[model samples]
Target: MQIFSFKKFLKEQFILLSLSAIVGILSALFIAFFLKLLEAATAYRNSHFQLLFLLPIAGWVIYLSYQYLGKNSSKGNNLIIKEAKGNQESVPAVMLPLVLFGTVITHLFGGSAGREGTAVQIGGTVAAKISEWCKLNQQLRSILLICGIGAGFSAVFGTPLTGFVFSLEVLVIGKMEYKAAPYSLIASLIANYFCLQLGIHHTKYFITSSIPMNGEWISIALKVGIASIGFGLAGYLFSYFIELFKKIYSKILPKAWMIPIFGGIIIIILGQWLVGKDYLGLGVDPNYPGAASIVGAFHAGGSFTWSWFWKLLFTTITLSAGFKGGEVTPLFFIGAALGNTLATLFNIPIDLLAGVGFIAVFAAATNTPLACTMMGIELFGAANLPFFAIGCFVAYYCSGHSGIYTSQNIGIAKNSFLQIRNNKLLSQHLSQKELFYHKKWTLVKNKYL
Candidate 1:
C-alpha cells in the first residue's frame, strides 16, 4: 500500500510540473503578443493626438463587445479570483481576447490604465481552458489556476520571485497559500525565461545613491517610515476613489454603456486641458522628455510635486469609467512620483525613496507586502531591502482594509481589535460596515430631532 501511494504521488507531481511548463509557455506567448500590440497602440496615439477624441466611441465598442460576446467575462480578474477560491463558475476562454482587445483600445484612445490585470486575466483564462481540456480534479485545477497567475505576472514583469510570491499572497489578505508555492515558482521561472527568450524586455529601475550604513540607518528608517504612511494613505484613497467613482457613474448614467462614454469625456477634459498628457496610457514612457513617468521618478526633479495626485486622479477616473487594463503600473507611477516629491521633504536620496515608493504603494494597494518587497530587490537590487520592507509592510498596514480587488477575502484580520470575521470578501465587509454606520447615524438623528 505504501509503495502504491508513493507511485501515485510521484505521477501526480510529474503531471503537475508538466502542466506548469505548458501554462508558462502559453502565457509568455500571449503576453508577448499583447505587449507588442499595446506598444503599437500607445505609439500611434502619441503621434496622432486627435485619437483622444474617439475615446467615447472606443469605450462604446468595448462595452458592446463585452455585452454581446463576453457573457460574465466583464467580471475580469474577480472571476479568476472567485474560481481560485472554490467558486463553481469557470473562467471563460473568451476573456483573454476580450480583455486584450479592450485594453488595447483603451490605450489607443488615451485611457489611463495599466497592463498587469489584463495579463493575469489572460493567464487565468488559459489555465482554466487547459484544466477543462485535461479534466483535472478541483484540487489540481486550483493549483494550476495559481500557476497561471504566476506565469502571466512573471512573463509580463520578468520577475519570477515576485510573481511566485504574489500568486500566493494576492488570493487572500493576511494569508499566504503555501500549498501552491512550488508549482507557482516553477511556472513563474519558466514563464520569465520564455518571455525573455522571446525578446521582451522589462523596464529597469536603479538606485544610484550610496547606501547609508552605521549611524545613518536610524535616520533613514525614520524617514522611510514617515513616507510609508503617506504611501498607505495614497493607496487607500486610490481604492476608495475607484469604488466611489464607479458608484457615482452608475447612479448618474441610466444606461450601462453610457458610463464609459461619460468617463471618456471626463478623461478627455482632464488629460487635454487640465492635467496635460503625462498621466495617460501605461505611463512607463511619456511622449516628451522630462515628462512624469515610472522611469523619470528616479531622478530629482524628474516629476512635478503634484504628479502623483494627477496620475491618481486620471487612473481612478479611467478605471472607474469602465476602461480596460490593470492598476499595478499606475500604482507604481503614483508611488514613485509621490516618493520623488517626499524625498525632498524627508531629506532622503531621490532614487532610493522613489524606488521604495514604487513597490510600497503597490504593496499597500494590493495588500501583498512580501511580493512588493521582492519586486524592489528585483528591480533595484538588494542593497536597500530593509527600506523596501519597512515601506511595503508599513504601507500594507496603513492602507487599512481597502484593496484593489473586491474578490479578495480577509483570511485573517489585520489587527486583533477589529473583530472582523475570517474568509469574508472585502466588498461584503465594506457593505456591512456601511450598514452599521448608517444604523448608528439614524439612531442619533431620531434621538436628537
Candidate 2:
C-alpha cells in the first residue's frame, strides 16, 4: 500500500508538471504573438501619424467589441487576480482574443499603454481552459492560474524569477503565497525559453556604476529613499487620476461611446499641440529626435523634467478612456524618466537613478516590492540590490493603500495601527475608511458647535 501510494504521488506530480509546461508553452506562444503585434502596430503608428486622428474611431471599435463580446472580460487584470484568489470560478476564453485585439488596436492608434495586461489575460484565459480540460481541483486550478500568469509575464519580459514572485505577490497585498511556487517557477522558466526560441528578445538595461556601501552608502540610501517617495507619489497620482478620469468621464459622458472619442480628441490635442508627441505610444524607444524613451533615460540628457508627468497624464487618460493595454511598461517609462530628473537634482549617477525609478515606481503602483526588486536584479544586475530593495520598499509604503488593481485585497494591512479589514478589497476598504472619516469628522464638528 505504501509503494502504491508513493507511485501515485509521483505520477500526480509528473502530470501536474507536464500540464504546467503545456500552459507555459501556450502562454509563450500567445505572448510572442502579442509582442510582435505590438511592435508592428507601434511601427505603423509612428510611420503614419495620420492614424493618430483615428484614435476615437479605434476607441469606438474597442468599446463596441467589449460591450458585445467582453462580458466579465472587460475587468482585465482584476478578473485574473480574482480568479487566482478563487473569488471567481473561471476566466473567460474570449478574454484571450479580446485583449489581444484590443491592445493591438490601442497601440496602432497610438494609445499610451503597456502589454502586460494582454499577456496576463492570455495566460489566465489559457489556464482556465486547461483547468476544465484536466478537471483540476480548486487547489490545482489556482496553481494552474499562477503558472499561467508567471509564464505569460516571464515570456513577455524574459524574467522568469521576477515573474514567479510577481505571480505570488501581485494577487494580494502584503502576502506572498508560495503554494504554487514550484509550478510557477517551472512555467516561468519554460515560457521564457519558448519565447527565446521564437526570437522574442526583451529589453536590456545595464548599470555600470559602482555603488559603494562604505562611507557614502548611508547618504546614498537616504537620497534614494527620498527620491523613491517621489516615485511612489507618481504612482499614486497615476492610480488616482485613472479613477478620477473614469468617474469624470462616466458622469459627464454617460455614454461609453462618447467617453473614448472625447478622450481620444484630448489625447490628440495634447500629443500634437502641447506636449509634442514625446509621451505617446510605448515610450520605450525614441520616436522623434531626442524623444524620451525608457532606454533613452539611461544616458545623459535622456529626459526632461516634465517627461514623467506627461507620460503619466497620457497613460491615465488613455487607459481611463477604455484603451486596452497594461499600465506596467508605461509606469516603467514614467519611473525611469522621473529618476533621470531626480538624478539631476540629487547628484546621483543618472543610470543608477533611472534604474532605481524603473523598478521603484512599478513596485509602488503594484504594491509588490519584492517582485519589483527581483525584476530590478533581472533587468539590471545585482550590484545595486540593496538600493533596489530600499527603493522598492520605500516606494511601496509611500504609494498609499491604493493600487492600479482595485480587486486586490489587503491580506495584511501595510500599517498594523490602522483599522484595515482583513480580506476586503482595497476599493472597499477605501470606501469604508472614507465613510468612517465622514462620520467621525461630522460628529466632532457637531460637538464643537
Candidate 3:
C-alpha cells in the first residue's frame, strides 16, 4: 500500500508539472499571435479604416456582449486579485477567448487600450481550466490559478521573475503567498523558456547615464522620500481617475458596454485632433526600444517626443469605459513620462529619472513596490540598484490609501499610527516594544511597570 501510494503521489506531481509546461507553451504561442494581431489591427484600424464608421459597429457588438454576458462579467486582473483572496470565484473558461476578442476589438476599433492584462488573463484562464477537470480544493485552485497568471505575464513581458513575483504578490495586495512562490517561479521560467525558444523576443530599452549616486545613506534618504511621494501621489491620482470615470459612467450610461465603446470613439476623436494618432494602445513609439528618455515640457528640441499626459488621459478613459487590457505597461509609460517631466527640477538625467518613475509609480499604484523595483532591476539592469530600492520604498509608502487590487487588506501601517508598539514586526502578543505618544524605552520600562 505504501509503495503504491508513493507511486500515485509521483504520478500526480508529474501530471501537474506536465500540464503546467503544456499550458506555458500554449501561453507563449498565444502571446506571439496576439502581439502580431495587435500590430496588424492597429495598422489597419488607424491607417486603412475610418474611425467614424468603425466605432459605432464596435459599440453595437459591445452592447450585445454586455447584454448576453451581463455586467457581472469578470473585471480582468482585478477579478484575479479577488480570487487570490479566497473568494473561490471560478473564472469562466471563456475568459481567455472573451478577453482576447475584446482586446482585439478594443484596439481594432481605435480604442487606446493595452494588451498585457488581457494576455495574462488568457494564459491564466487557460491554466485555471485544469482546476475544473481535476476538482482542486480552494488552496490548490489558488496555486493553479497563480501559476497560470505567471505563465501569461511571463510570456507577455518576457521577464520571468517579474511575472512570478507579480503572480505571488498580486494575490492579496500586501500579503505574499509563500507556498505559491515555488510553483509560480517554476511555471514562469518554463513559460519564458518556451516563449523565447519560439523567437518571442523581449522588449528592450537603451540607457545613456547612471543615476550618479554617491553611495551615502543620507543621499539615498532624500531621493527615496521625494520619488516615493511622487509615485505614491501618482498612484492615488490613478485610482482617483478610475473612481471619477465610474461615477460619470453610472450617471450617464445605460449599462457597462456603452462606456468603452464611447471611450473608443473619444480616443479616436482626440487622436485625430490634439495629439495625432501615434499615441494609442499599450504604448506608443515613445515607449518602444531605443526610446528610453522622454522630452522636457519646456524644451522644444526634437530629439525625442513623449506625450505623457495624453497617454495617461487616453488610457484612463479607455479603461474606465470597460475596455480590457494590461494596465502595467501603460503605467510603465506614464511613470517614465512623469519622471521625464521632473528632469529639470532634480538635475538628474532624463533617462535615469524616467527609469525610476517607470517602475516606481506602477509599484505605488498597484501596491507592489518591491516587485516593481525588482522589475526595474530585471528589465532595466541593476546599475542603479540603490535608487530603485529607495524609489520603490518611498513610492509604496507615499501611495496613501489606494490600491489597484481592491480586495487587498491593509496589513502594514497606512500612515503614522500607533501599533501595539512601534514594532513593525510584531510578536503574537504586544511586547515591550510599544510606542507611547513619542518615546522608545525597552524591557527595563516594562519591568518597572
Candidate 4:
C-alpha cells in the first residue's frame, strides 16, 4: 500500500502540473497574438502617420490607464519579480488586460515602448488566476507563476530553452526552488508549440557564419574583452538614466502625468526634427535594409551611426514617461550597435564584437550573466561560447550594483573585499560599500595577543 500510494501521489501531482502548464501556454499564446497586433499597428503609425497625431493618442492612453488602472498598474513587473522570490501572492489578474491595452496603446501612438512586458504580464496573470482557483500553496503558486513567465517569453521570442533559464535565473537572488523546473519546461514547450502553430514569431538576432576552426581565437578573445567595456558601461548608463529621469520627473518636472505629456511632446519634436521617427517604437525594423546592413557591418568592422543614439534616447524617455515593456532587448540593440561601432576603433573582428555586445549588456542590465551566457550559446551557437563566457562574466562584474530592477538583492559584491562593513569579511554579502576598498590591514606581530 505504501509503495502504491507513493506512485499515486506522483501521478496526481504530475497531472495537476500538466494542467497548470497548459494554462500557462495558452495564456502566452493569447498574449502573443495581441502583442503582434500592437507591433503591426506601431509599424504602420511610425511609417505612415504624422508625429502631431501621436501626442494626443499618448495623452488619451495615459489618461485611460490612469483612470481605469491607476498609477499603481505599471508596477506589475516589479510586483511579479517580488512575488516570485517567496512573496506568496501572485500578480493580479486584472493586471494582464490593463498592461496589454496600455502597452498596445502606447506603441500605437508612438509612445516608444516594447512588447515583451505585455506578453509576460498576460501569461503571469493567467497563471496567478489558476493558482487562486486551485487554492495552491505558496510554493506551488510561485511555480505556476514562473511557468507563465517562461511560456510567455518562449512563445514571443521563440527561444524555449533560454526562456526557461531566464525564468529561473531572473529569480536568482539565491537558493532556487528545484520544483519549479518541470512546470517551467512544460509551459515553455507548450507555448513554443502554439507559436509554431500560429506562425507567430518575434525578432531574433543571430550569428549565421561558423567560427573558423583553430583560427583567430586570440583576436576573438581580445575583441570580447574590449567590447565588454562598452557593454558594461552602457548597461550601467541605462540604469542611471532611468533613475535620473524618474528624479527629473518626480522631483524636478511639473507633475506625474504632465511629465509624460512633456516627454511626449519633446519626443514628437525631437523625433521629427532631430533624429527622425525610426527610433520611436519597439526598435524592430526588418523592412529597413539598413537593419540588415548594420547587422552585417558588425562582422565588417563598422560603428553605430548618430541615429542609434537618438533611438536610445527616445526609448529611455518613452519608458520614463510611464509607457510599458522591458529594457532587456533594447539593451541588446544598443549594445550590438555600440559594440560594432567601437570595434572599429580596435580594428578587431566585427562579428566577435557584435556577439559580445549583444549578451554583455543584457547580463549587466538584468544582472543575469549566467543566463545571458547560455543565451549567447543558444542564439549564436556553441562555437562562440568561450569568448561569450569571458566577455559576459567580466561585463557582468564591471556593471557594478546598478540594475534596471530596483528590487534585485545584492547577493554578493561584484568583486571580493577582504573586509566588508567593518567586520572581517568571511564572505561577501550585499552591503552599502564602495565597489572596491583596500584589503584589511593586520599587523602579525601582536594580532589578538
Best by lDDT: 1
Residue-by-residue lDDT tens digits, candidate 2, 1-449:
44468887787788779988999999999899889988898888889978899999999999999989888888998988888888655687888999999999989988899888888889988987999898887878888888888998898889999999999999889998798899899999999999999989788888888977787888888999999999999988889899889989999996779988989999999988888788888888987879889999998888888899999999999999999999999999999999999998998899999999999999999999999999999999898998899999999999889899888989998888887778889889767766889999999999997
Candidate 4 TM-score, C-alpha based: 0.85
Candidate 2: lDDT of 70? 87
The TM-score of candidate 1 is 0.97
Model 3 gets an lDDT of 0.67
Q: Kindly give the stretch of ten consecutive residues in candidate 2 with the minimal lDDT sum.
A: 1-10
- Candidates in order, TM-scores: namely 0.97, 0.95, 0.82, 0.85
Q: Between candidates 3 and 4, which one is better according to TM-score? A: 4
lDDT of 3 at 222: 69
Clashes of 2: 0
Q: Candidate 1 at residue 280, lDDT?
A: 83
**What C-alpha lDDT values do all the predictions have?**
0.91, 0.90, 0.67, 0.68
Clashing pairs in 1: none
**Tens digits of lDDT, candidate 3, 266-358:** 776777676655456555443333332233211223123355566667778877777766677767777777776665456666666677777
lDDT of 4 by residue, 181-217 (tens): 8778788778877777777755556675455656576
- Model 4: runs farther than 4 Å from truth? 1-12, 51-53, 56-60, 88-90, 173-177, 209-215, 286-303, 306-308, 418-449
Candidate 1: count of backbone clashes, pairs at least 3 residues apart or interchain: 0
Q: Write the per-residue lDDT of candidate 1 for residues 5-85, one digit (tens) a residue.
A: 888899899989999889999999999999889989999998987899999899889999999999899998888888777
